[model samples]
Target chain A: MGITSGRGRLRTVSATAAVLALSGTGLVAYGLSKQDTATPPSPGRSTAAAESPSGAASSPPPARKGAAYAVPQGDVLDRSQPTRVRIPSLKVDTDVIDLGLQPNRRMEVPQNGKQAGWFTGSPTPGQLGPSIVAAHVTWQSKRGVFFELGAMKPGQRIEVDRQDGTTAAFQVDQVGQYPKASFPTEKVYGTVDRAELRLITCGGVYDGDSGHHLDNIVVFAHLVPSTAPHAHHTG
Target chain B: MRTTTKLALAAPAACAMIFAGASGAHADDGTYTMKLTDTMGNNSGSHSTATVHVMGDQLKVHITGSGFTPNSPHAQHFHGSFSENKNFTCPTSAADTNGDGQVSTEEGLPMYGDIMISLTTKGDTSPKSGLAVDRMPVADAQGNLSYDRTITLPAGAGAKLKNLHIVQHGLDANGNDKYDLDALGESTFAKSLGVSGIPQEATNPATCGTVSGASVGAEPTGGVDTGDGTTQGVEDVGILGLGALTLAGAGGAWAYRRRLGRQS
Candidate 1:
């Protein structure tokens, strides 16, 4: 009877220890996650310019005498096709495919919704005009690259890796939700003198009958001018 | 919800009409597009997209623009050389011949030539109405303008439509949001139009683009099907895992306390 009692106590202690170990591990994981959320990994180059105090002053001055009201010729990049996109806040990293017009002249969408599609008709990312990058919020039984796109706030960062071996970083200027019926085509696709970007995905209530969302979430952003000498070029 | 659904249903049909009207190709029908950009070196944050659809002699001109002086009439026109052999282009900052810091209308004439067709809201659509500010389209309160009109082209004007420059004139040079002679002095082309005391802001070219084939293309209308609704209403997996962990920890603590009680 005494031996059995001792063994039972030992078993209980062992179980408690095991539980404590698991709880400790959970706390450690929680800590790591908190750290991740607080400080996203700062990628090299672009982040350096963004963090610098003189970043704004370093940009080229507005055109000559009419400087007061003139739109600052912000850094415009040469035309280059974007190959990849990364939204650090959403932890979205995906390959970008070229999307052309369909036979009916509508913009083509990504086939599986896992990858992002850059509209080939618009200017490439970091060009003078608005560059469009679109991805799905969710695929069949899976979350797409831009699933949390609607949750993104202004001032977040979106990085696009271009075919020219350069990464163009963009700072979110606004996040807008519009009904699919009035999608503000001109605002989304309008011409801007500076390098701008538009990240789009489906949002709002999902309709089971139509099998689509009722609204679109668009993230408007502008290229963060690099500190490199080439950033001074203006058209 | 019902109204929203009805709007959704009607939107696609309206979009189809716009796309067809903008790009439909037929015999004697051609669509030309222009991407308007700032004429002066100073980026005015003003831009526009002009689409001209020519069906025989009927010309349908549609223009959408923003970043203009609000609530002010912007005189827009198709400017090109009358000579069939000569083609004109948009002027650059060098066109500011008088060094007034703004590109005046007469200074840009060498590049954009004379006004071929005045885009007016009513009445005449001729060069005679070029400076007729009251006849031009006034931008809305937000400094955005949308102009759509169908005009009967004069004989042989359809052929001259290609390669012409589309110029949107009028700006707030002094940032006062009104056309006045305070900032850049009197207008250079005001005398030519027989209108005196016109400010340079009233006649200065704001935006310019060269009319070309429909190769400019149109943006896709409406929303995209970007989701299949698989993950809707589901919490983030990471958060769910964390919640499960927390619950288990609490459960373990309670069990641990009960065991201590029994041991005591």
Candidate 2:
């Protein structure tokens, strides 16, 4: 019985090797044929569907040089307006309002402490470039929506629900505090290579003379891939 | 070599002719308003409006804004081409060099011509005078400044507001007591100004506007508030109420957190 089992195992190994060799040849031919096709390879067109279902199982597609971030794997959320923001770590959720330039040409702050204002002039939360959402740290002595923003740590998750059903998840990267006198307007409001978020609120010492805070607390974050694979990132 | 000298001499003659025409046109009286619009990408919420009443060489400038930083000084200038036929306009987003998103006063110069008058607190209003950015005044505690003053402009002062553009600077970016060319650039300038890694509230363009026509003594439309700084008492009460509510919310949150801790 042991002799018979050994012979059967050897036969099975041989069969497996032959099958693997054939598959390899077929793969090579498939690749050659793709190159021989009249149409050039479209880098923007993802080959995720043609590859293995598991992204880790397949060899990576050629990197698009000069591209800033990873190409999303599935459907990307459209440029819909954001309506609300929720940070799980802070246990805070608040409505959002559209903000425009004040007569002084400054960003108009949200009058209500419970809500935040998203600068409409900037990109939407999920679109490319930095999207800004500003709120008051304190209104009249009450805490504003972003009052606890400074306490948040890196890797905490934030979700902004948009006018569309889609919600863009964001992971916190860093938190910083700057005096109002030296606010980094360019860094906070400037263009970035990828979709970004900036949560701002007044911080530091309160100046009674100006009736404003001396510093502004900022939280920087980037979009987290949704469970549903998108065109840009792996799920 | 002779032709080059002749061209140089012709340049002076042409300049003299233009100056003569400007002087001749200075006597025409007209009322114009500078609706100080904010530049693209800066959202400081400042609204400044100035009415320039011209009567020959004497120019009466009535300046007002919603508010400025209580004690922060701002430098402003009347820039652009001052010509009878030339109509200068405010710069578009194309002026944002280096793509930092906010255009500085220097960056907008290509679109608007050179500075025409240095809107100084007190000094020379000559086109070549560089003191506009140096001698500006600080805004009051209420972010208000209402100064009704008559200043003398150079000959052909009537051409001054022909296509005037008002650019306001937030504060001395480098705090060097004067505006330096390098001080106008961001990042590097902010560092030199000792404001690196902080909000650039001190060095931003406060507000900007183009010259528009408005009647004399008329309240300029938009955001120029001429209120007599007496509205703080009622606002203080409202703020106190909000503060009380915030305290109550904090108390509830603390109790809830304590409960969660006990349970955990």
Candidate 3:
């Protein structure tokens, strides 16, 4: 009776092993098939970044000549709509557009991944609160403006050109990645005493079933008072 | 109880005065916003945005939130000590002095101060109604709550409302989806206030935010869906599948070898 039971156990183990082998082979084939179609540009290899006129990745672009105004002494700037955003290290330069909350109260993303949108609800780029700028990591198959957002490190420079023709320069302070389910809304959007900026984009494992990234990459930055001095275009 | 009665009686007179002075514009009459956030160490994923329209003594508060204890009454209040000149802000996990994982109302008082106004759905928006659970706004089936109410601020309440923090109370400590005393035991705040049989989950500060003067716009909840899975790393998936296939093949071969050996 003991021998018969041992043989039965062995048969069960063999059957389970065979099943795992079959599924594993199937999964490998599926992964290979996926590799053939998935050709989206990887992070830091954006064509837009390469084509930008300002090829230098270390220094900020020269300030556009306009009506020169005395740079404000404080970090905070008067409320002005942001027109463009440039990240020197990542070679990201994109036109800024306005974004509002969706009907569900979630932040609305840009129509495509190419442009970055400034949250209308937040304080303007150099204003005395957190200014939210968001873009997609990838739209459908194209790279987004913030595709390399997660790769950003502290001390990297981000410049936002305001509608008033003054540029708001910000120094990256910290970068964080959080699960979408537990996104720290307050830390990201809460009222801060100083002029700050938050850049957001999708990250983490992409769930094929949900067709969305599972995490969000947030970059925290503060206005660099020394670099904030720029001429406001009165025209 | 005395203060509740006094405020209830004084409410009508205040309304009459507001209506009489309706034509005159008050300089402080503007929109103020508060971005509510989690107060306790537990990442409850609860957050809310409140838009307060201050028109003279009348405050029309519209609060919308998601990820709270579903279908449970959330006791919210404007917490601050205006006369004492205390520093009012949201409490962090460090506020949990008792070493328990939760930050109780009493523990958070130092950071958020006392309740100045109870954000009840029906009546009595005073500190006396601080634990008026039945009167508070109840989250829906989806753990979302939207509250819109116009409350008459007490005589000196307007001046004190500046920079005050809004505290939204209630949490599901045991993941039971309902407020009960089983999880974290009885409410210390409620017991101190001479109320009993109330669960700590019903009174713990779940989300808190400082009120700031700003234009009214919806604050976003949760992380935004920023990717379309187009740029997912396929190489990683391929590598993972290859490793799994290798392991499975090795296991199957071993199992077959053992079975053949036993048969022989």
Candidate 4:
């Protein structure tokens, strides 16, 4: 699917939802209809819904910040879809699942505890913005896929194997844990000029009553320069 | 045996028992062990145990667990005594009233008493005790978490720990991440959050067990004990020797600089 065409469809979908006074549920229902077949709407075309800062991170602005490291110069991946992730340091070898937005506008967590999930609403793992992947810290008293995510030190590498015959490599830069109450929405979902990878999971104090983690552990990494050549940038 | 002879034997035994009780539920210098087992209806295939050492008002707790969610944090707490007409024991499959295939934390509450102390992560203590389920430190990469902490529990709470249940909560598969009635189907999460009046399947108690006195001088499995004083001394000496080496190297360098200046 063409990125330009996908953006056009998203604009149309958003307009229709607004005119119909769709609830969050209706909006998600519409979102899913358009999500699978098209690439995520690009940051270049500013949608009014995305411009709003009030909602669950509304929309991310265009990539205004320069990359901290040198990005691949040639064709980036065409959002070809990542199928699995392997982190040798973490001894993590798991399948990557697809996720979409919930009625709350937050990305749906991977339903399965064992699998890592990619946000279908964001760019694919090798895309130009922060491609989000998340899993539970623990599931049903069992540890989820990204359980040891916080222990990831800088310089460690994460590999995402895509449907295309290529693998996207990301080198860790920072791994920080923040309370869920003060989650850095802008920093995580904001637009960046290069392909970035974010692995997120619950951490901090576990509230037994609520059965949820109070904090979120985030691992930030950028695409390795060499892996960029293998990416087919449809954008 | 003669009555007088039997009384002589019984009196000393009774006196000794009284003296032990007067000392405290647990000796200040003694250690207690808590063996954890999977709770009723929740099968996670994890084994865990905790050892508590009471030193004055401070309680040192050492917890070791394996077969848990790899690198994840499991919310834990010491529930109130089972002596208050409550079972205070981990629930069983029969406790699955609604037939949800699993016994939730709320469903098992009648068996385990009120939460006495919440073993939370860094920075938070009582009052916000139960608030820690989500913010605690996580397990390591191997689905194992070994934690040790020294904290003061509520007054009299530590004394009753031997009769209390240590409960660990379960996870939400939907990833709504919060205890919501919509995703969890009107469970304890709703009651804790006050969204629902009645608790549905709130918190899921994955594993649970109780604390009991470990024999004095018995080989302690896990606790603040160093196993042997000699081993600890050796470690201290090693650290001190490293420090001494660094100081000697600096002194040697300084002496060489002075000699070089004199020759020049």
Candidate 5:
């Protein structure tokens, strides 16, 4: 309860501010397909801050650490498809390929199934924006890149050691299940003006015929400024 | 003023109110949205600040600056409990309860609020924070549910968005949508979204921001953070509707009290 305000007097208080604690203004994310879970688009209005289940009015995060990273304010880079991703938390380190729109903007599962494919729709990791990294939990072949992503807990450490020297470290903060149609892509992959990441894998109950997992496993983390982040990643 | 300033300087513990409001805006869920500011005091020169947006049911997010790596992705969320509330604002002081000089969040001693949000890169940094379905928030804590107390920066050009300073908004972004950020509350967007009146609770509350006993958020139910100008660091912002909730609870409490009287 780091709350400092309520019915209307400014009491001025403070609580733990995690993002500012990390000292970076950007994050990473990838895209996955799902139906919208928000109260329909409502025509002219975009989404409001997530309302309290109780319907209280509030806004988003505002804690800032007086730290600055030299992020290049320039052109959008063309992202190459990520062939694979490695999540040490789940004992997964595998290759990934690209998924295209012909297949309706999804990743192609590896034939032998050693790995899952990356959606071309989102940004590639270390590439400047949010990137979608997904893997199959199980296949006729095997477990995929993000296979164990769902099992992670808070305070658990994760490192995406990119092929390049720049490796991003993320501390797990949240995990949950969502129906295929309930995925908030714009909320998740639309645009945030920062670098971010998203790891996806099929989970929940598996529907054999539909081939869709009852839910999707999403792991969220931020790129810690590697004292020596990859040369290409930093400006 | 300098002595009070000296007393309030650097001692984050003394300014727990400030931090809670900060974390509440950036982390807390439901009725909580904290914001942070730099250089405490009314004398204003701007720095950086941010406003958290816990969109959908997932994360607390804030995407400022130029476009996110242009056609790229970024991982983001409030790195703690992320819930939404119907209304709220920031609190700026501590209410002495139980005669204790210190303010806290414990049940009997101190009860404050907080907000928070964080970001990470992928494959070396990102966590799914936007526009993706297969990938949603991984943990409850990782969800972004808070905001940075908005501030203004001196060098406000290169990355105006990154500076977490809360602006004395003239144009209503009305919940963070730049598309309608300047549509003036006269359009269909304003009428449809219902952004007409300033949040009533924000303007008036049933409680006086103080409590005789250990109240919620330092003051009693329905307090606010003057941290917007008086303090620095983080601040809690929860429209607990507690003041409202308490109203609903009064009938229940009285009935229970009467029942106890008869039982005795």
Candidate 6:
């Protein structure tokens, strides 16, 4: 009888010890998670983790931890221009380039390697003002970013990251397809507090003779948080 | 076999409850398949799939189609689904929540946007064109698109496409259409985009679990992308599950017996 009782006590102790170890391990794991989230990050991180209460955000763009916005002072120089965008919902991943007016006042294609340019005049994405990035529907023998712009819709995500480690996450508000002759550059690229981002591509009347789309597809998105600027870099 | 049985049994109740439920027949994801037809020409142009991805009340759409006339411009639209006894395309979600049911509009109720998808002509031509999504009005049961944008077609389109269906819609598979947040403030990806926030009726067919077979010749990259563009990495997932149901969890006692001495 004593032996049996002793065995039963051992089983109970084992179970208790297991529970204690698991709980301790769980606490440590949770602590690590907290540490990992101590500092907010750029939107491009694309991580899946538990959210911390109050969503500790970093600088300029005021989206939660994952998508931090930017504040551009002057023409902040960097190695690479933040061109090209990706939107999962739109299933678009394309390069961006500024489309200076052609002789006919149409957008131009980038001459170099997969480069998408931002309109120098506009506020870059992740910063104040509207960020305008344009790319060719087809350049040379190939197509460029925003090539499939017309296919995008609202509620999709558009991400533009700069070399300075700041990224702007643009949540599409509208996608408009208009004639290239009436590109509506002014309305599409208007300045606003919302950290708006617009993706422009050619569509509309496809002139088989000219071999280019006649109209433009414009996607509009606002900053995830336009009212609140983040505290900037965390850690 | 199991799913077939479940589907068959649920079909009747689901059909009955659909009308009894939401005033409007809406999909949680609001994704759809669009087939463009020129009633005037008596021709069917093309059919494509679109998912109006919603993020935090924001709606966006993603579209994919094969056999498209590259470089052609075609108008796009969202039309009302067919009413009962109306001769219309099959698989209209608004009228039939279950594939087995149908209802008519003359009964004083019209399903909104029974037909979804605006026409887009495909062909190569200089000078692009397309329409703003919001500008396009929601469709009523008459199969009419917003603004009667239906009168004409864009120039230069010729092709045949098949298998038009909304690939993936809704939030976290079986979860809510909005982002799922615990008291801890953790946000589910589904929540960041409002697709997860939609009501129960808007979900896509049960078979679409984020990973369905794609057509041949696709790059087969074998990695699922994380939405952010700057990240050049891909996560390898032989099984791309947005989230799948785990039916075995309810059997706690049996699970414990197999754990051999493992304690939670």
Query: How many clashing pairs in candidate 1?
Result: 0
Write candidate 5's Cα lDDT for A50-99 as tens digits. 11133442533221111121222222222344544555556666666644
Candidate 1 chain B worst ten-residue window by lDDT: B12-21
Candidates 1 onward: DockQ, in order: 0.10, 0.02, 0.10, 0.01, 0.01, 0.01
Task: Look at candidate 5 and tell me the lDDT of residue B112.
Answer: 20
Query: What is the C-alpha lDDT profile of model 2 across B133-203, one tens digit per residue?
Result: 35666677676655566788777856456356776666334444333446544434345545454234455
Worst 10 residues of 1 chain A by lDDT: A63-72
Q: Which prediction has more favorable DockQ, 3 or 6?
A: 3
- Candidate 4 deviation (Cα RMSD): 26.7
What is the lDDT, from 0 to 100, of the residue B56 in candidate 6?
24
Model 2 DockQ, alpha carbons vs. true complex: 0.02
Please give the TM-score that candidate 1 achieves against the real structure. Answer: 0.44
Candidate that scores best on TM-score: 1
How much does each candidate deviate at the interface, measured as C-alpha RMSD after superposition?
A: 13.9, 23.8, 23.1, 27.8, 26.1, 28.1
- lDDT agreement with native, every candidate: 0.66, 0.53, 0.68, 0.54, 0.30, 0.33
Residue ranges of candidate 6 with Cα displaced over 4 Å: A1-84, A90-107, A112-114, A140-143, A209-211, A225-235, B1-264
DockQ of 4: 0.01
Give lDDT tens digits, candidate 3, residues A1-235.
Answer: 1323567598877777668656533333333332212122121212222233565856432211111111112457766889999998889999998776666567777777788888777778887668889877765555667777888878888999999989999988988776677778878886565678899887654544345555677899988854433323334
The residue pairs in collision within model 1 are none
> Is candidate 2 or 6 superior in lDDT?
2
What CAPRI-style quality would you assign to candidate 2? incorrect
Cα displacement (Å) at residue B239, model 1: 17
Instruction: State which candidate, 2 or 3, has the greater lDDT.
Output: 3
Query: Model 3 chain A — which ten-residue stretch has the worst lDDT?
Result: A63-72
RMSD of each: 22.4, 26.5, 28.2, 26.7, 28.7, 28.4
lDDT, candidate 5, at B178:
25
What DockQ does candidate 3 score? 0.10
Model 6 lDDT per residue over A1-235, tens place:
1323567598877777668657534443443343313123222211122222335644222111211111122222222346556666646665665433233322233443245556443445654445556554443323344445556656667777665665556677876655444445546653243346666544332232333333455677776632223313445
